[model samples]
Target: MNAQTDHASTVSGRQVARAALWLDLLHRQFPELIEELAPGRTGAPGRSAPPPDAAASARRSAADRADRDAALWNEQHGLRGAGGGSAPLRLHVSDALRDITDGVVELEEAIRDRLGLGRPPRADVPARLRRIAGLLASVADHPVLAEHVLAECRRMSRRCSAALGEAEQLVRVRGRCPWCDSVSLRAFPAWRAVLCVNPGCRCTEADCECRTSPGHRHTWAETSWSQLALDAGVDESELAVLVEAAEPADGSGSVSGSESVGGSGSAA
Candidate 1:
């Protein structure tokens, strides 16, 4: 598969595994919550009876069974209240859902940190959080809440997948520093500048005089593309316009600030 596809698949797999582990932990910690959320009747002991849709029955496969098992493990672990549920039991379930929602937030943060990119503004995050909170506050059973949480986790996973693809593209633009043979060299695609990894080297790809004393440079400074863009003869306003124009309205490829291009939009 292509790099983007591979990255996305890896991300989705990791997220699914993490989600499964967290769900298992949640199930163990609050068995009663699981029981309350079980698919069966209010007082039934097992999974709720399956609907008699022929299409659903026909579509059942090994994957479907696995999903059902996961759902059961995550949601169906508790016993229903005999009459009115105990206050403590209800409180525990509510707390668990809220805790799970918090965990989802943490997961998203961790993904962004790992990807090494600042989290761009997302219009979906607030709404997702609200939905999770609403699910927690409502009288939904554990299974229902677990399903919603899992779905939200997958949505975040998809978002991360997209981010990772963007990162891969940035890495390609930020080519290696030939002076020190360092792949960690920085690039500002907009400015068409690249920096050597050695701090003393201070040599940008656009100016290579520092190569004379590269042996003395040890640490590397983080490259700033905006400043470099100005150094390359583009004003801030022009850079902003270039950035906006280069970005596809369809959201396919992001305009990476560190792209390296030759004089005519060809690869250097």
Candidate 2:
């Protein structure tokens, strides 16, 4: 192949790999998502529950307060009855999963048509994902078509991730933000940055010249995380804990903010 063709092939191969990897991850995480959405059950016999730490207790309290607030708001706004509870949230999750499944099926049909392939066999989401990955691999030689397919794959992967509760997994930082002096610092592992989530913080404007931008924000990149720890008077060990907490619970590789369908998109 010519040099141009070689470059196109390389790009297409990389995109295909990334798209397939995301789909595979979603397939693996599907069971965990279902378990989380399902009602909690009693601990198994001979297996004791771990005692809640102070942090865990505090988190539970905060969550309870938030739930109560949500219930009050819903009741006042006629969004739900007096004691609606978490049923509505569960319904939304179900609808989101259904939509993602439908999109995947449609994409499968589209790809089969583009590749002059026959209808796919009736299968579950995991099986469909495997089939889609195989179809994407077949199209890698045609760069333009591969690009479109890869874009669709990325879009579906992102939707699947969000529906499965894998996106926006923010970890709270222990100390105040060094730049903003706000206690709203959070580590966004996908972006590999720690930032203040407070809206009124001026850190972004101080760093950049986008003073007039309404939603401007700033982050301390991985390179500067150590500096942030020092500035915030957080110990190195504590900083390490924050990093560990930011990692995916399943130990899967994080999908970086830059890897979305559009090159300029942010996963955060």
Candidate 3:
């Protein structure tokens, strides 16, 4: 049992590390995607800049920008408040980052699992895969290449599905509300916060510009591992272990040593 657990831990660690590498590459290579889709970075969705006016100029602060973006997004999506005005956007920009980051990781993992090769530790995995598939696609009417590329595209689609799976998993987790969870569509991990992808969730607590709904219920607890570690006065290594144990992994209450939302990805 001990040996099996150790092996699983090792495999899981490698998988997470490789996924992180891909995310880094994606961040580096296609930063525009990050800028457009990433939380906080994502601007007002599907809305053109308003005509210049004193009021528009007044809403130039980052917090105001985020609020306008969220409001515009909610309006475009036809997601009106249940009882009255706009539903207070509960999820924030960090939540958006978390969703996109987790989605990218899961997509990489899915591709690897489906291809049965995972991502080879050579160059940028997604880029490499895309290049190969593109080259194959360029070869017109070649049966073998066509078959191979088709297979690759099919697997890629599965990656999209896997990316979605993470959101579904996050939605029903013990502490958060289903509406918040459902609204959370993508995530991208940052140094300290998880970005929320849902347009409705586009601000951080510190910069929130949205009105709070009385019915809005946040189920997640407010426990801080770093604060706890500081209070405990543990060494770096000890703090690492304690922090790992406290995070929700694979939706299991117990730590499985596998990285998740609040895991090494966040540290990255």
Which candidate tops TM-score? 2
Output the lDDT of residue 55, model 1. 70
RMSD of every candidate to native, in Å, equals 20.9, 13.4, 17.1
The local distance difference test score of each candidate is 0.40, 0.64, 0.36
Worst 10 residues of 2 by lDDT: 258-267
191-250 per-residue lDDT for model 1 (tens digits): 333444445445555444464564533222324445634444334444334332322212
Total backbone collisions, model 3: 25
lDDT of 3 by residue, 1-268 (tens): 9897676555444333333333333333333333433334334788765566876677655555675577668778967545332223323333443554454454445444444655534444355444343332233233333333333333333233333222212211111112233323111111111223333432234434422533332222223333423432323344333322322233222212222332221110
Candidate number with the higher TM-score (1 or 3): 1
* Per-prediction TM-score: 0.23, 0.50, 0.22
Candidate 2: clashing pairs of residues: none
Off by over 4 Å in 2: 41-84, 167-198, 201-253, 256-268
Please count the clashing residue pairs in each candidate, in the order shown. Answer: 12, 0, 25
Better of 2 and 3 by TM-score: 2
Please report, as a residue range, the 10-residue window in candidate 1 with the lowest summed lDDT. 163-172
Cα deviation at 26, candidate 2, in Å, is: 1.3
